[model samples]
Structures are given as structure tokens and as C-alpha cells.
Target chain A: MKTLLNKDQLNITLQRLAHQLVENHLSFKDTAIIGIQPRGIYLSDRIAHMVRNITGQKRIDYGRLDITFYRDDVQSRDIQVPSDTDIAFSIENKSVILIDDVLHTGRTIRSAMDALIDYGRPKNVELLVLVDRRFSRELPIQPDYVGHTVDTILTQKVKVYWKEKDGKDEVVLIDKV
Target chain B: MPLSVKHLLGIKELTVQDIEQIFQTADEFKQVLQRPIKKVPTLRDTTVANIFFENSTRTRLSFELAEKRLGADVVNFSASGSSVSKGETLIDTVNNILAMKVDMVVMRHSASGAPWFLANHIDASIVNAGDGINEHPTQALLDSFSIRERLGSLKGKRIAIIGDIMHSRVALSNIYCLAKLGAEVTVSGPPTLIPKHIESLGVRVEYNVKKALEWCDVANVLRIQLERQHKPLFSTLREYALFYGINKQMLDGLKKKIIIMHPGPINRGVEINSDVADSGQSIILNQVENGVAIRMAVIYLLSGKKDAQLSI
Candidate 1:
């Protein structure tokens, strides 16, 4: 396992991403932010907090989306207990930004897109990721906002850890021997 | 893990973990039901045949809707006006259906173990919709699902299976399922209607309906199987209703909030009063709604598509 981003690097990347979000979404009136469930939630929560701090916004509409049922590999894997999806506000005619920790197969993003439609049709949707594992995407999905781009093989797995969840914030790439 | 069994023959064949797995899958499908599209292309290439030798409206329609919603090609086969009426054997009829490249068979037969028998003879997956008084696995599953939904867990919860225990497949299946899930089960009914050796199944036997109601957290009232009864178990319907029937007054008399559940085709005045069936405490309608999702979960898991995902 190789450590790609330590605590300092992770914090710097989050601030940069939050600043970029504020620059593009400027008051975020008709904009909504959603975090992919299980892993993406921590990053989305961190970014949402950073964005609120940087933009001085009172409340940024953020929610969690679970794409377990919408995935392309339901039966093959062990039965999964689905996480809570708590989208309280409507995404109708809003600019929606979907956040995740890692982008590899791109199937998770595709499932997230499919699941997002069930809430309501958004005017537009964009993707943001903490780690973009280039050349391994199964679907034609590209992240609009990327924190780090790492070149990895199909055999390697990239994981992001947060202090709130893992007691430390770091991104690691585990390679199969 | 995904269910290890190739076919869902009965609740007897399913472990507690298997039932929980099915419920977890159903939970996901329940959310799908709430969506606007209300359909998922999960079983796109799969084909299922609903073969009912006995007559049914709710179970048949529920299974059909589940199959359709999961994007499976469905073929409905009723025994009436078919080869079975012309004295064809069960295997012959199923074999003929299987010849059509049917992937799975959802069967409801008048005779017990019909699905099990078919499972042994055929290569296709067999799901027992209901097989006589033997077991109705899906009904039991949905009942447990509804209980878990309302109460949050089944462990050590008190459930009273009221009325016709002797002839109820729901009672048998529920006994196995609820007991396996760590619920305290009590079968309450008149002496003749309560099956023999039921206590051996690890449930208390309650003779008085009022006392049973007072003891249980949930009362699953069942309709007296009028068609299945060759000899009269009770003298009159009025006498049974007066003694064992669940009504609003009886519920109010309990002075404790208890969830009311009934496997459908309820004998309105005979087993349960119309008012109580439609009351605030009743989860009968939720049971019906959950039936579709439960069936979809069963069909999806049994579809045997190792890597298939929900599409569209």
C-alpha cells in the first residue's frame, strides 16, 4: 500500500475544491449537492463544510445517495445492507453536483446518476471526485472537479480515509501482489 | 451472501439468515416501488411462468405485477380449461411449460409439496406461491417483513396467530419463520381448529382469543379455511365469530396498542370485523403493498443472473 495524500495534502485539496465550487456556483441558489453513500459521504460532508466556511453560506443543501440497488452488479456480490438516502429537498431544475471519494470503474457514478433521477429531474448534473484513477473507467464518466489524478492499473485499488471515520485522513493505493 | 438455494420450496428450506437476506433485498425494491417509474429492468432476459392450479386473484396479480415490474416476460397458466382438467399429470403439464424455455416456475397448487416435486423433476427454478395447506412461503415472508417494518425487529416480540391454525398454510409458514427469527409465537383458536403438536413447534397455545390479544404485540388473524374443511370444526360461523373473531370493541377492550394483521381474503364478519381491518392499527394494506416488493425480491434473487444489475 502506498500513501498518496497525507493529512496536510488532504486538507489543502479539500480547500481548493471548496474554493473552486464557490467560484463556479456563486450563491448556489438553485444548486444542490449530493454525496454518494458509504464512502463518498465523508468527502462530501467535508467539502460541504469547507464550502460553507469559504462562501459564508448559511446552509448548503446536502444529502446522501445510496446506489446499491442501482448498481450493475447486484446479484454477484454478497447481499448488501443499503445505507440511508436522505435527500430532503427537490433537485428539479437545479444544478446538481455529485461527489464521491474515488472514480475507477465509473459504474458507481452511472448508478448514482440513475438513482438521482428518482428524486426529480435536475437541470444539469456534474461529478466531483477526490481521486480519479485514470484509464480504468468502464463507463464514459469524467469528473468535473478532481482533487487528485493517479495513474493506476486494474489490479490496484484506491481508497480514501477520513479522520471522522478512520481516525486519520489519507488516500492509499493497495496493489495486488 | 445471495441465497444458496436453487429453488424456494418452502419456509422450511430457508434459514433465518436467508429470510433476512430476502427482506434486505425487498427493502431496496420497496424504495423502487416508491419511485415514479416503478419499474426496473433487472430481469430483462429472464422468463417466468405463473402456473396456478388453484384459483386466486391477489396472489396471482401480485406475482404478475412483480414479474412485470422487474422486466421479466411472464406467461400466466391457470389449470382451469387447461390440460390438467383433461386428466394430464402434474409433471406432464410442467414439462410442457418447461419445453417453452420457461426460466422459472411460480406455482400455486391445491396439493401440498407440488413445487417441491416439480423442483426434483425439472431443471427450472421453482417458487412455491402456495401449495395447499403445506406452506405459503412468500405470504409468511411478507408478513414477517411487515412486522419488522412496523416493530423494527422480530427478536422476542410476541405474535399471536389467531384463528384456523389447523388448516392455515400461513400459520405453518409463519410458525417456522417467526420462530426462526426469534419471535415468541402463540397459535390461538378453538380446540378443533388448533393443530395437534403445535406446541412442539416452540409456540404457546392459547385457547381464548381475548387472553391471546392481551398477551401478543401483534395479532395475525386468519380467515377460517371454509373450502379446506371437510368436517365442521366449529358448529356455526356466528359462534366462532362471537368467541374468536377480532372486532374493534375487542381491540378497544385490550387497552393496549397491538398491530393487527391478516393474510387477505378475510372473512369480514366471521374472523375480523370490517372496521378493525380498516383501522389505524391495521397493517393489512401495507402487507399487500409489501407483497409486490417481496415477490420482486424473490424473483430477482432466484433469477440466477450472477452479475445482473437493475437497468432502466
Candidate 2:
């Protein structure tokens, strides 16, 4: 099995992603990072931690969003968990960075963005994905930030296992050979 | 392949197995409470929209907390703040939200069966918080949960639900849930308010509270909102309270073990006496706490199953 983004490479990718966030985001103040729940949440937390360490800012709020209930795929999949929007701090007028682990067909990001707008309008919503796999997006959507891009067959699957979840930090491309 | 119930529209939409599955799942999720962290990552990437077309701070907040604790995102839309107040039809507003791709919808509308309409139109799972006074299935589930917790079993138990039967969705859902679980159900209310053919659902019906009170292990008092007294259903509030309210004396009429229950924001001295409301046997707060647990089960079960298939 060929490993993509081994532990060290994953660390570098996260650090680069963190630096990219710092460079792209104009101000640390009034900026909030909300991770799409499950994998995105951990990614966002890491991003937030990296941003804080790099910029030495302490006021930015990091939140987790579970977009289960607000899904078009509700008919196809059983929502294992109810959606949770745990924003301890208010999101009104704040600039939000919507973070996710992967960008596939762009449906989940669209849903996450939809979920974010309901909390109260943010000054801006920038989409950030760890991996950008070029697939046929059903909607006209694109990520504002990306860590890496990959081209794969439609039948192939990308499995992202983080140390916090699968006891390792790695991304695996599983092909239907 | 778990049973998915994203939005609960009404009890009418649920099969007996569907109802049983929810109760069972609620039983499992109840364990989370015993842990230090009362949260689950089941809905780790999902978001729930709480669309309330009615004024209900309690149900809205309960659903919100339930979603948050289960690790799902919650988006709230109230009639006052949302576009509905600006002459937007319920369909238009829901479609707009659906465009954003919400996973499930827990709706409470002033009009009866509005959530059903939304379920038909949208792809989100629908949980009917309250549809006018037609049905509050979760309230019924919580009420049943409280009863099951107190009695340990429901078979052959005499459970009497009193007050505003005609306009009480709580009474309607409770009747179905309790009867399904083998409770000897009796509904007592003014005949004017008690709808026709209600007794056909296999529950005994009575107009006199005293007669109903004498034969029950649990006397579940339904709230008597003044708004429900619409068009002079009753001549005087005092007369109604005196005649029907569950008070200290009424407690004596029943066996000492008969528990008192109310789905509150209580009418206080109106539907139930303050002493009874605050009494040792009052399961009102228990109902509130259990409401969340039952709702978590509902969200978990409802959201976990796919729409096109009935079996999970």
C-alpha cells in the first residue's frame, strides 16, 4: 500500500495550511474558524491552534458545526447524530473560515455554508479544505483555500485518518481495482 | 443501516416498529447521561434546522440542546426573526433553507399539520415539535418516558389524562403512545372540548374528573391555556379551575401512589394546584429532563435512517 501524506508530511501540510490561513485572513481579531463536524472539527482546531501560535492572538473563536440535519442526502443516509452548532461566542458580523477535511462534490461545504449563514450573517465566509479532489461538483462551488489537489477516478475513494481519530495522521486513496 | 428519522412530522407517519425503535434508541442514549461527557459524535458533520412558526422558547431550546449534545449543528428560524413575518409562505422559507442543504428539520408551526406539508416538500428529516394543536409527538414520547421511568412498566396501568382534550395535541399523542404500550387510558375533559370518535382509539373517555381520578395510577394533567378557552368554551376561569384543576384535595381522592404529571410552562393555579405542581409526586420537571433524552433518541433514530426505505 502506498501511503500519501505520512505523519511528518501531514504535520507540514497542516503547518502550511495554518500559514496560508494567516496569510489569507487579513486580521486575527473578529475572525472565527468553524469546523464542519467529525473530521473537519479536528482540522479546524489544529488550524486555530496553529493560527494562535503563529500570530500570537488569543481572541479568535473556534467552533464546531454538525450539519447532519441540514443535509440534502437525508433521504439516502441515516444521520447517525443530530446536528450540533456549538457556538459559545456570538458569530454576528465575524469573519468565518469554514473548514473541512476534504472537498469532493462540494455538497457538504455548501451545506456547511448554509448552516453558517443561519447562525447570523458573518462578514465573510471563506471555504477551506485539506484536500481538493477534482470531481464533478453538482453545484457551482469552489474552495477559497486548499492544502493539496488530487485527480482520481470517479469510483476511487479518499479516506482521511487523523491521529485524533484513526490513531495516525494520513490520507489514503482507495481505488476500486 | 439504521432507521433514519430526520424530521418527525407526526405520530400518524410512524409505524409501531418505528415508535418502538425510537424508544429503544432513547434507552441506549440514556446511558450518555451517566457519563462525565454527555455528548456523542453521531451527527458529527450534520446540521439541524429548528424552524418554529410559533412562539415556543422551550421546544426550540430543547431541540437545539439535543442537537448540540449529540454533536450536530443547529440553525434556528423563528417566525419573528425569519422571512415568514415578512409575508413569506412557509414553503418558500423552507425551500430557501433547503437550498442551503440542512439535514433535518424539527418544525413547530401554529397551523396544524404544517410540518407534514414541509416533510412532503423538503428532503430533510422532519420532526414535528408541535403542529398547531394537532400533535406534539415528542411531548407524548417524553410523557411516556416519564411514565415508564416512574412505573417501571406500563401494562395494565391506569393512566388518566385530564383537560383541554379537544385542543390538546399532548393528549392525542399520549393516548396513542400509552395505549400502544398497554396502559388502560382514560381521557376526561369537558365534552365540548373532547373531539368526537376519540374514544374509538381504544381509550375510555369521561367528562367527570372525579370519576376518572378515582381509578388511575397516574393522573397526567394537561395544561389549560386561556387561549384554548377560545369562543367561550368555558364561562369562567375560576369555575373551570375549581371544577377541573388537580389540587391537594384531588390528590386525596386518588390512591397515595398515584403520580401527578404536567407538560409545563404550567398554568399554575389554572390547570394544576401549586402544591401539586410543587409536590413530591410531580413529574413535570422529570418530563422536561426526559424530553431531551427522548428527543435525542428521536433525532438519532430519525436522522439515522434513509428516507426511501422503511427498515433501518
Candidate 3:
């Protein structure tokens, strides 16, 4: 079955995620929000804003991380390229939530986790993804908090877009076959 | 809260993944070049401003090419006729052009960390074309790209960055990138010009250039800043050449399969002899060409299309 999170639903999901994060981990003192570059950064920002409102003030620092280089499968492909990875702030010891739009084969998140560790070790590294399309596990990694979960076949693609990051808001699924 | 920049200050703020994406995207651009048209509409309607506070021919021209080829309107700015010469502050000058609502600003400055300063105040997206002697990120990207193209992989490769480590922004940036990408980087230069804390960045420092040249797969010769002689770093041009220049004889002692590189506008016989600069293994021109595509990747990413489905 195909499931999609419309704008309203996605907003609600984000609100709940923020509340859960606050309830599960009390106090925003050592909490830092890091969005995976591209989409995760927007979610991280949204979550940070929510956290600030809940605490009645700004209580968390945030950063954006790009994990394109840390991937293990780069050179095996036909292209061997590198790009700019911008993190406006430092990623010192703090509770970091590595945000990404979707969690699929888990390779991107895996690489992002590795890349984050290189910057510095955070006290707690949590994974928060918008969509979790269940499939066979590549690495033994799972999301700490998932907005929605759907079972899917291997020959499909899960896409997520946000107005702040992708110029629109919606989630779509496509048949790769 | 998150902020947007109209310019890229430096790669110091960039993580390995962002850089890797640039390389991956540039690698895609390289494939595009193989075709007959060799152009894309990815940056169509975007206006790119090349605001150079310092003089640069290759970097400026390459950025222009990258912008135009991506179908963006390109504007070239220099300090020669601008208000900068009249003692206008950088903020005032940047604020003036930003008022025009340009899409992006690609800048090169002489003062270290000047780009970061601009990024802090501006709302527009910024690409640090070159910032002082602090970072030449695109240069490092192109250099790394060229090395990967020739040597297959950057894993465990030994690279020696020779000359003026303390004064060479290329050396500083390269050490961070090369080391991050898994290259055992060694920086060799004169004792006075080599900073004491370079090893902190995971690079070994050496004072003897000849010895360093013999031990690596790649030898990056930094341009001897002719302007530094007056600052008491070195006595004379001839003295500088005698000690650190990459002459043809020095090339023979190093591994025959080694690659030679420079960030360009070479001083000919000073940092590198013309023969070595023009040698078969010299990837200087390739670096210049790769620089355009690599910069295109940087501009695309900093354009804030990170979440968009960017298809080549």
C-alpha cells in the first residue's frame, strides 16, 4: 500500500516528533539540532523552532550537515566527484539529531552518521527521518524517531519535499521498475 | 535559527559530505562536457556576481564560464574601478550590490576570513571564490578531482604540498581536504614559512622540499608569493628558487609516476621550473578546466537546491 503525508499531516507529525524529543530527553541544555544537508536541515530547523517555543526561549543550537562524500559507494560508480559540505556552526559534544528526509536502504544516513562523527563526537547521535519505507536492512541502523512507516517493495522510490528546502511540500512514491 | 548567505566565505565551514557532493556533481558535469552541447539549464535565470576584492584571472574567468555555461547571467566585479579604492568599507560595497537582488555572489578577497564576515551579514547565497590566503576551496576540489581521475582513488595516497605552508592558503585548505579524503598529506616548506601547528590538522610538516618530493604520489607546489619577500620571509627571488623551486632534476628523483600541480599563475622558475610545469604529468591545465565544473557544483549546492531532485 502507498501512503503519502500531505502538508497538514506532515506538520502535525513534526509537532509530535518535537514533543516526543522533549519528553524522552528532558532539558534542552546539551541538545543540538543538525539537519542533513538538502532536506534534513529544514526539518532540523523546524524542530529547533518548536523546541524553542516549548521551552519559552531559544535553548538549542543547530547545524546542517552534508554526507555526500562519506558514502562508501562513490568511487564504484562511473563518476568520481566531490562537493562543498557547509556546516555553519560547530558540531562539538552535544545531543545531535541527524535529520534526513527519508530513510530507505539506510546508506545516506549511515554515511551522514559517519561524517558527523568526523566533525566531532556528539554526546548522543540520534536519527530522525521523515519517511521510513521498510525494506531489507543494509546496515544494522534504524531511525530513533520516524514520522511515518510504510511497507514497500524493492522496485520503488520514496521522495519527500519541503517548502523551505525543495520549493514545495509533499511526499510521493514512484515505481522504479 | 538558520541564515542564508549571498556569498561563500570559505570551505572551513563546509563538511566532507558537502564537498563530496560537489565532486560528485562535478563528476556529473564532466560527463556533460563529453557530449557535443556541454551545457545545462540548471542555473537558468540565476544571476551570479563575481565580486573580486583581489585580482584573479583564471579563477574569475573560470567562474564566469561556469555560470554562463549553466545558463546564468554573470557579472564581474573588481576593486579597480569600484568604490573600494575610494576607501569604502566592504559591508557598504556588498550592501550596494545586494540591493539589486542578485541570486548569488561569488567572491575572492585578499584578507583572510573576509568571506565569512560577508556571509554573516548578507542574506544572499555566497560562494567563496578565494578568500585571502585562507582557502581556495574550488582549487582544492579541482586538485583533488584531478588526482582521483589520474590515480584512481584518494585512499591512503601520499601527497606532499611544498612551499610556504604558513602563507599558502592552498596548503592549508588542501591539508584539511586531502586528509579528510584519506590521503596521507605531508606539507614541506622553508622553516620560517611553515607554521608550527600544521600537524594538528593531521599533516606532517617537513622543511626539505627535495626529500618531500621523493616520497609522494603527488607533489603540489604552491606559488611563491613574490609579494612576501618584502615582509622578511625570504631574502631574494634567487634565494627562494635555489632552496624550494621544483626544478626538472628534482622531478627525476621523485617517483616517476608522480603528478605535479600548482594553483596556477605560476612564477615560472620560482616555485616550479617551466619544464616541470609544462611536463607531461603536469595537471595544471586540467585543474583549471576541472575548476569550472567544480565551481559550478559549489554554486548549485549553495543555491539552496539541496533538497531538490537534481538530475544531470
Docking class of 1: acceptable
Candidate 2 per-residue lDDT over residues B122-223, each given as its tens digit: 777778998877899999888877888888978899999999888888888888888777799999977777888987989898888988888888989987
TM per candidate, chain B: 0.97, 0.94, 0.92
Instruction: Flag regions of model 3 displaced more than 4 Å.
Output: A2-177, B1-7, B228-230, B305-312
True contacts kept of 2: 0.25
Candidate 2 segments exceeding 4 Å error: A1-177, B4-7, B305-307
lDDT tens string, model 3, B212-284? 8878889988987755444778787788899998888878765566899999789988989999999997998
| Model 2 TM-score relative to the real fold | 0.64
Q: How would you encode candidate 2's per-residue C-alpha lDDT over A1-177 as one tens digit per residue?
A: 356677788889999988888897746788889999867887888899999989888777888886654566654554444434566676789889899998888888877776666567789888888888876677888888887788876788777888877798888788876
Local accuracy by lDDT, each model: 0.89, 0.79, 0.76
Interface RMSD of each: 3.2, 8.6, 13.5
Local error of candidate 2 at residue A116 (angstroms): 31
Sorted on lDDT, best first, the list reads 1, 2, 3
Encode model 1's per-residue lDDT on B20-72: one tens digit a residue: 88898788788778877788766667789999999888899999999999878
Q: RMSD in angstroms, all models?
A: 3.3, 11.2, 18.2
Report how far off residue A171 is in candidate 1 (Å). 1.6
10 residues in a row with least lDDT, candidate 1 chain A:
A74-83
